[model samples]
Target: MSILVIGATGTIGSLITQRLADAGAEVKALVRQAGKREFPAIVTEVVADLTDVPSMRVALSSVRTLFLLNAVTPDEVTQALITLNLAREAGIERIVYLSVIHADRFTNVPHFTGKHTVERMIQSLEMPATILRPAYFMQNDRMVQQTIQDYSMYPMPIGSAGVSMIDARDIADVAVAELLRRDKASSALEPLTLELVGPQPLTGASAANIWSAALGREITYGGDDVAAFEGQLASYGPTWLAYDMRLMMTGIQRFGMQSTEGTVEKLQTLIGHPLRTYEDFVREAVAEG
Candidate 1:
């Protein structure tokens, strides 16, 4: 029973591949540019593009489980549908998708809507699937590294809203568990969705405090001007991405990004240990900087 991980060179996907490989499963990585990827020697690397169904078919051959994640792009929905169909046709039995929390509720945001569309497609499939909907990742902090460095501040227009952030490592751990477990009962094999989140929820101000502690400086929350922040993002990022971010931020501010339940319990049960805290992630990010 081999597991094939799509987008295996990416942050979360790479970690999932490593975890599955370490667990003694036959791991295969499907990467767009095969030669550029530096995976563990124990794992097999296959070159394939999700948009190219023939290539994806070749990549899916002989794989029993697939861990699906894709780069954020305009064509994500089409690519996902193509890959999901190909995987099903190739006899892949289980699919574990990494999706964003509140996908069903945030149809206005392109990224969340894209993920939600894929989740619906997966649910409609005959294959057993698990959709892991993790909340805003603490890893998102990396995006504001320069702001934190320059002004000792982190800015999010989401005001006092607290979000239940999860570390990408925990997401990968649970995904690998589902991929490597061969004895998954048929009842358990039915399509399911799990909300993955950190141990606790923290407000934007609290997150700034955490950054302040980690960086040894007073980092503060800056503004709640969503329009201004959106304009700022547009000045730096791609126009489509800026629009998407603006829409996403609007949803976060209005509905909040926090999960109502603790996804850490499921993560801990899968890994046989406690999930890493937001503080731990901050420390690691700072150390890496």
Candidate 2:
């Protein structure tokens, strides 16, 4: 069976593609730009844009499993609707979707709402689907690499609240396993929601300490000013996008984004190993740079 991975060049998508390829599955990497082909030699690269339904259909024609991942955009809902329709029409048996944590509760945030909409659409389809809701990524720390290198600080609005931040690589691993095992005989496998998380929940101060130890430098927690953080993000990102991220952070601090019990155990059973901790992610990320 062939597996098609959308956004294959992205952070989490790339890891999923690699894992599937390593497992001896016939993997196809979908990319909008021809020049962005970066997967290993075993992966077949297909060029298709998410907005073009016909092209996507052509890409999905011979695929049995699909990994759906998309960045937030104004046309997210339309794109997801068309893509899911095309996949079902093309006879795809299973889909593994990467979604944000607390998507259903955070309706005011456009991006999270978009993800929730897609999740509902996936449920409506007849194909077997696994919806993975992951909390804030520990990989987000990479965005502050420059700050960590220069000022030795990481800024976030999470305050002292502990978040069950996950590593993107771990998320990819679980997605790959689900796609590969879609046809396996299991009574408990259909229409499942997996709450993916890291080995432990950590506060901003704890995260800073982990990074500081990993990087062998002093790292400090900058601030808990959600409005100021939103203002700074707005200068670089779209207005709605900035607002959504700020609102999500505020919700995290207030409601606590830590996953419920058994998250790690369930994920480990799927991936066949233990999830990576914040400290482990820090060391690997630093080594890669």
Question: Please, what is the TM-score per model?
Answer: 0.93, 0.93
List where candidate 1 sits over 4 angstroms from the true fold: 182-188
71-176: candidate 1 lDDT, tens digit per residue? 8899999988899888878877788888889999998999899999898887765568888888887788788877887988788765666677888888887787
lDDT of 2 at 140: 86
Candidate 2 positional error at 289, Å: 4.8
- Candidate 2 lDDT tens digits, 1-289: 5889987998999998898888888899999988585788899999998889789979999887788988778888788778888888887767888888888987877888899988988877545788889988888878877777688887876777688889898888888888888734343257878888888888878888887998898899877889988998899889888888898888787766778888789889888888888888888878898
RMSD of every candidate to native, in Å, equals 2.0, 2.1
Q: List the residue pairs that clash in candidate 1.
A: none
